[model samples]
Target: MASAPQTQSLPLFYKELIPLSRQDHAKYKMRPPETAPFLANVHAVPVTVEEFPMVQRRMPIVFSVGDDAVPLALMGLNEGVNLFVDDEGKLTDNTVYLPAYIRRYPFLLARLQPESEELSLCFDPSVDWIGEFDDGEALFTDGEPSEFTKQIMQFNEQFEQAGQRTAQFVKDLREMDLLMDGEVSIQPEGAPQPFIYRGFQMINEDKLREMRGDQLRKIVQNGMLPLIYAHLMSLSLMRDLFGEQMRSGKMPQPDAGV
Candidate 1:
């Protein structure tokens, strides 16, 4: 769901990335987009371990499939559907917690040179938020980044750090052999067969219970146990998401096979 910028492929939601600099963009201003059309069809998004509790309350937390598994918040049970947002990508309910990955859109810290250890603040040039607009927050003030720019930079930095911790959390789960291929089946009334959803990873609750006491204590001491439980707890919300899709008439036909 989240990808790093590379020479061959740009990260999700970014069409083109350029390092933000005063020299080239002294007059650029940032205005919040009234709608996020990019998110209209995105069903899932990468999320950090730090957001487990809050995310669990609103959506199912599942791991992306494959060797390099990362946590994802399921905005919808199926592809091309988002239960929480309208077609214009505006939140249907304002109280839902928006993931940091969504909120940090159009801006991220990336390495300007692949060989360099330092990262620079970069933004997607295609987004309407940043441009030479007259009615928005100035990106630069007197040849320096303005307070708003500084705050955005800081937020991206913190997101990067959270991403690092999330990576480690996933690594630890793999090391402990705790993740398993996940699936969920739901049968609506009058349906002849249940709808099945797969292609994700989830905590192996049985194996988690079978772990040695010392290992369990270690996870508890390291503050990972709660996060793991939070993920497990969130799985129950999958049905709620399915219901939301049904209510919105976004659910696939019974024979469509999700």
Candidate 2:
């Protein structure tokens, strides 16, 4: 759910990546897409530690399964469903906090070559946001990046930094052996069986509580305890999300299984 994209493996919502350059795209302009059709069917999106406070309030915060367990904001409990966004990819609730991972779509900082130490601003060519359009923000000014382009580059750079910090946070959790397979069961009225959801990882609350005083203090000092608590608090929202799905008639039949 939170696999990092490599050169050989394209990232989610991106069909083809092309390095942004003045020579190749001097006439290109950027305009926001009318609707994000790419997000219509995506359920889980990778999130960073920096976004925990806001993200937790809006959606359940869980970790993806596997060795590279990254925090994921559960937009929907099941795959190919997003309760927050409608079929057009527009948010059903305008106030919902959109994850940075989604906001940074179509543009990212990527290494041009596998062996290169430097990263370049790259974008998905398939997106309609960037093109040689008559009406949009210019990508270049006098053969150099325009202010808009520079701002985009800056945002992607910050995202990369946040990603690194998030990686460290996950590493710390793994070192403390605090991650465990997560499960959530929801029983609706008159349902014969509860809907059981699995295939995700979450913090082991028991292990966290059992940690030595010194270790606890260390985490508190490092500002991880609050983030952990935020994640724990967000779990309750899973039911709220399930309810939304049910109300929208998006929930599958009980026998279908999640």
Candidate 3:
């Protein structure tokens, strides 16, 4: 019920996050989201385990190398570059599947208190599309959440559930030592040199091949084997992405980090 401008670390596009309070924001309304300009600069986005099959079809699914080791759908090959998004924040290929993480933008669940385990639905108040308005979907009606707000709450709740499963997926991968430093290289036809990309992590196929039969059966029964194969197959698309970069003449120059 309280407004929090600086509560916790928000995702890439969020500016000011505030808990949705009917008491203080009874009249605020949300305009339909368009273009998703906030996502323009994001090169990668976290994806849930359930989304691996769909996401892997459109982009390479890699793991962020760290203790967290979250799954990320890479939208670009280099840092701060998103090949899928255009200058206006619109997707370049409409046929490409969009990640739920991006579709649930501006609205997300957050823990208001750092020490508390309970989370509350929160939104970025600074988003231009949300404000006190005479028209558009109302956030609340008669001091209670409206149907629109209820739907957003439902979506965020599902997102939270997906996050839990994603965490478990990472834990399983880590326990099996399936994650390892990854590198990819692409050579354009008739080009003198190939472009090499790094700074990410991928499944260790060698370790996967060496797993015990019981372990492999367990992973297969859990529906993780397909996800693993999807991620492995998606790596081939990295060259396709490089092709797009080449066509756009935005191939990044070789740098120390790369």
Candidate 2 lDDT over 11-121, as tens digits, reads 788888878888889899999776788999998899999999999998999998899989999898888889888899888888889999999888988887777788888
TM-score pick, better of 2 and 3:
2
Residue-level lDDT for 250 in candidate 2: 82
Q: Which pairs in model 3 have colliding backbones?
A: none
TM-score of 2: 0.95
Candidates' lDDT values, in order? 0.88, 0.88, 0.84
Which ten-residue region of model 1 has the weakest summed lDDT?
1-10
**All-Cα superposition RMSD per candidate:** 3.2, 3.6, 1.7
- What lDDT does candidate 3 reach at residue 190? 86
